[model samples]
Target chain A: MSFQISSQPIDLAVLRNALAHPHAGACATFEGWVRNHNDGRPVLSLEYEAYAGLAEKEGARILAEACAKFDLVAALAVHRTGHLQLGDLAVWVGVTAAHRDGAFGACRYIIDEAKARLPVWKKEHYADGVSAWLNCAIRGGFSTAAGPPSGPPTG
Target chain B: MKTVRIQYFALLREQRGVGQETLATAAATAGELYAELRSRHGFTLPADRLRVAINGEFAPWDASLTDGVELVFIPPVAGG
Candidate 1:
């Protein structure tokens, strides 16, 4: 029942311990890290910003949904905000359940749902003067370096 | 009358120039209230690309509004 959206870095050990319980026979964790390159350019850094209150609320909702839909015993999700360097952990999600299938399914659901629904946004800082908005296509099965969106421009 | 708490995030926050606000309106649906806010704030957002959460649950724009409900607007972004 832990949900947090903070500017501070996430503590993985704490998350792992929280998911360790007798009732849970399996635990699944997902960590999202900042990459060094995007769109064939060297990324300087990334700044993640979010409406903290809303983000937390959304995380809780997603957690609740997972619990309701799966046989999960416990769940924790945390997303980092503010400036982050390359290879920094951007998001962490851990789920524990009575069986392997439930743990894996719930963990995947949480990560995909968070990316699709969370209010957090990333600003990619590159070596060149150019920067672009990051469109999180979790289910779109495409790479981030696919160039600028070929569709009509968005406001 | 109902008062809805509205929260903006990321680029939308920058565009709106504020993070949160409470609107006291007689609007029946979230979509109506969003239209009012867009006109007042003079900000353009791709409503189809964005998602809305009412009281911590993902909801459609046509969802009915209630007093003291927290309305959150989320823009699409990447994460692992």
Candidate 2:
């Protein structure tokens, strides 16, 4: 089990290969990308900043909690900090287990817990020459009971 | 008396106007020490929204404090 908080974008191929195993029947993966828009405004980019040491520690705790809750064989979570442009991979989570349910459940739980508990913030820059700092409490509006990364809004 | 090392991040750091501090107090619990620090620094943090971590593990506000422990106050952030 490995949990990392990094400034570089996550390499999906590397993560996929690392989680592949002979005994594992299922491998579940989650990728978070920087979107171009939020609330109908064209977003230029986002700046992610973190309290590096504490964030990594909280991430490790979340990983441990998920592993205990689910029957996962292995789990890895990586989140990107610093400046991120649109279409860049912001986060990645991969879980492997003997069964599909465990892999899927652990993957979802890890992402949700990280968002709710981790200490990383994003500053959204819009095309209209406006930017705003969004914190965890306010961003909870974007999260649902199922989890975050809910996709774009409907017209 | 024990010394607790405090670290702040994100909005909390900006709001407190300081990143870190060390306090020597006779308070027995994390909450108690926080109360003393808040009073001394005059920082206005909402009790419910803030999360506290002791020695890299999340702890409740009322958790006990230990000598030379690191306490982090996280004010929440967006995670992708």
Candidate 3:
């Protein structure tokens, strides 16, 4: 399992190849992109920041937890920091397993956990010439019972 | 009294007008330290809206303070 934070654009092909294994028959991947709008407001761009030390540690732990909770061969995730234009990839998760269920389950688990647990923040630059730091409020509270990201991530 | 290094991020960093600082403090735990700094810095966020980290690890608000520690007050995060 590997978790990394990159300031540059993520290379998806590299990540996909890294998860290749002879025993793995299934692969699942997720990509979070910067959308053109959010909360009914137009978004021109986004900036991401991270407390690298804790983020990497927590992110890796999330991947490890997903591997344990599901049968998997490998799990990897990358989160990008710095300025990102609309449609740019903000985060990516990939998993490989012997079966489709394990791969898909672990992939979802990793992204959800990483969003809630990692010490990273996102700032949205709106077309209205205002930029604000997004919080759990937009998502209607932290880590809902239905499976959204939670606070502190240690839980 | 103990001296600790503190780092801020996002809103806190912008509000504090600096990313990091070092200070000697009389507070005994992370919670007290945040209260103290909140007053001194006029930070707008409440204790309940934040989390604490000591030496690059997530720590409880009531975690005890120690000399020469690196501390961070994490705001609500939105990653993914």
Who wins the lDDT comparison? 3
Poorest 10 consecutive residues by lDDT, candidate 3 chain A: A146-155
lDDT of 2 at B75: 62
lDDT digits (tens) for residues A7-88 of candidate 1: 8889888889877889999998888888777656788788888766767887898999999999799999998888888788
Q: Residues B1-79, candidate 1, lDDT per residue (tens digit)?
A: 8998988876667778988888798878877877777788765564656688888667899999989999877767554
The runs of at least 3 residues in candidate 3 whose Cα sits more than 4 Å from the true structure, single-residue gaps closed, are A136-155
Which interface RMSD does candidate 1 score? 8.2
Q: Candidates' lDDT values, in order?
A: 0.77, 0.76, 0.85
Clashing pairs in 3: none
Clashes of 2: 0
Residue pairs clashing, model 2: none
Ranking by lDDT: 3, 1, 2
Task: State the lDDT at A128 in candidate 1.
Answer: 84
Q: Kindly list the per-residue Cα lDDT of model 3 for residues B15-59, writing each as its tens digit.
A: 899999999999999999999988988776777777889999999
Model 2 agreement with the true structure over A1-155: per-residue lDDT tens digits: 77888988688888888888888998888888888887677888988777777778778888888889987778888988888888888888889989989888998899888877678877788898977656433433342212343332110
Worst 10 residues of 2 chain A by lDDT: A146-155
